[model samples]
Target chain A: MLKEVTAATFENEVLQSDKPVLVDFNADWCGPCQMLKPTLDKLAEELDNVKVVSVNIDNEDEIAYKYNVSSIPCLVMFEGGAEVRRSVGLKPRPELIKFING
Target chain B: MYDIIIIGAGPAGMTAAIYARRASKSVLVLEALTYGGQIINTPDIENYPVAAHISGFEFATKVYEQAEALGAEFVFEKAVGITDSGTCKKVKTTENEYECKAVIIATGSANRKLGIEGEDGLVGRGVSYCATCDGAFYRGKTVAVAGGGNTALEDALYLADLAEKVYIVHRRDSFRGDETTVNTLKQRSNVEFVYNSNVTKLIADKRLTAIEVTDKLTGETREIPVDGLFVAIGRVPENRGFAQLITLDDAGYISAGEDCLTNVPGIFAAGDGRTKDVRQLVTAASDGAVAATAAVRFVASLE
Candidate 1:
């Protein structure tokens, strides 16, 4: 299961994590986000070196506002307690890997 | 002569350039406007196969970069005309003329405007032609879609998926779209059908606020508040200049033969500008590949 994080816990849970963290900033009503959830979960399960968490924009306003989340289904990657890469929406599994490896 | 001179840097043109470049052919793409063409204004492309989902701008940008990576040269110039010299073709842009062994016309099409007041000024702001491009921006907001055609229905359905409510304002009493689509839209609780209504004015300054719809039956003018208005009336192919050089259909679209051959030798047409049954991006890309392949074969025959 992808760890559910709130605005209060996002920084500590995702940004300050020891392992590489993939934070999914999305909303429940978004169809594309729903389509992307399974893929994200699968990636988390397969890749043990990475930690995956989800943040609901509707519930977590501070983190969303900080990231300037204009659109939903945004995926931000953090490695060793720092922001590394961020993607706006759902990307192909292979493309996501390329982003991680790059 | 240069191997190929592909007109327009749209998806069709860019794809052709990529293929021709990979085949070691010298490819030059003449573009009037930006790289993406009509697809640039589009927000997202969900129906495009293999991509799953991506913004049309992003997808077109990826194609542009990929074509560039394969060594395709791009020039930003509006093509005025093309003259065939039997063995070679001379493509005349606004600034200069280019001589090439073969040419591919991929000028594509443009969105047909509503022609109502404030329509032109509010294009990207509130009045939009592409729902996939602007739908996400109108999330939880209300929007209106004009026209009753297939494109209009699809746009309304797509917008309904994102927007809180989608009002389909059509001039006719019934939609001319597919029955399944009409049924599906009618089933959607958020979609409202405003029949026999035509948009008289698009009122907005910084962004779209509301639209004045005039009822054809009662001549009643009603103002509906909405954040966005999607116009899906139709498209006009950009083939005015090329019409004098090639055989064009009644609608000013290019008339291409079975092998994507234009009336003029060494000249071919592809994508929405060409005479084809389908005008989807997949088919457009396929047309580009086919046209480039045919042009390559035609060039090889010269030797």
Candidate 2:
């Protein structure tokens, strides 16, 4: 299951977590966000050492602003509380897996 | 070796899978992004025959399901390279590589971005290439759409119903879209046309706030306070990955004719990625059918 993270809980859930976290910065109004739901869900289920979380830009604008997330369906990989990589737009499952592993 | 491998999952690629499966050829489809391609950005599709007014997502999903039911296997992977061996072809993707007797390049096109200042930085904040994907975010607010093509007109029309006001900024005095679409947009009270003008700058800080429009003939510039800017200029073919394996036109589209036959003997090109006169849903489907038939014939010759 994909966990929903807010600005208040972002530090504990994503930044300070032991496992690498994949943060999906998305909004309800974005169509690509809707399209990316299944791929993220699958990634969350398949990966053991990674935590997948979602932050709605509409609700958690501060977190979005902090990460400089200007686009919907922005996938940010956080390792040791620092952003290691970021990808914009909808990517397929295989590419998502490759991205997370890399 | 697999009988055929198609590198894309859009309408053309999916249609090729259907035809290849019907021909009793083992088929594999690899897609880089989510299925549906640019059509997913379209809110409504009216031109596809028999489907008068279906959402682009629904249309693409139905076609995908049809292909799936026909026993064609699909994998979500981006093809990074293609190599033609003496008797077979090798396709390298982000995840894995596959060998096949025949290959079909059906990768479609991506939306063209407005290379204006701040356009890249403000992509998600307020600037978007797909109006249907981001239009709801700017509901009841003012927005501007650039270009004079069918996509631009469609974006303006779609935004008119959602936004308080929409400005269609076109470099040409007239639109290149269908007359009926232009007429429909002109009827909307919320739609405004900025003809013979270009978007010179994008004004934004945290997000998009406004845009600068310059009149080409008058040399007058005006700033429109818009919450979002939808760029619909055109699309560029997604053909860079396989450039080494096939010949490309000046515009980067694969050099293919109506038969979907590329310069490579066993490799075929189809859909919007190929050089064609008309890039439409119907034409894409037609290309898929032709390419699959040609691929099946090539495989038979090898046998």
Winning model by DockQ: 2
The local lDDT score (0 to 100) that residue B248 gets in candidate 2 is 98
Residue A37 of model 2: what lDDT? 86
**Candidate 2 global CA lDDT score:** 0.87
Candidate 2's DockQ is 0.31
Model 1 off-target regions past 4 Å?
Answer: A1-102, B39-58, B205-207, B217-220
Index of the highest-lDDT prediction: 2
Clashing pairs in 1: B42-B133, B43-B133, B44-B132
Give per-candidate clash totals. 3, 2
In candidate 2, position B77 carries an lDDT of 79
- For each candidate, what TM-score against the reference? 0.69, 0.81
lDDT tens digits, residues B97-204, model 2? 999999999999887887877776677778888777766667788999999998888889888999999999999998667999999999999999999999999888
Best by TM-score: 2
Candidate 1's C-alpha lDDT? Answer: 0.82
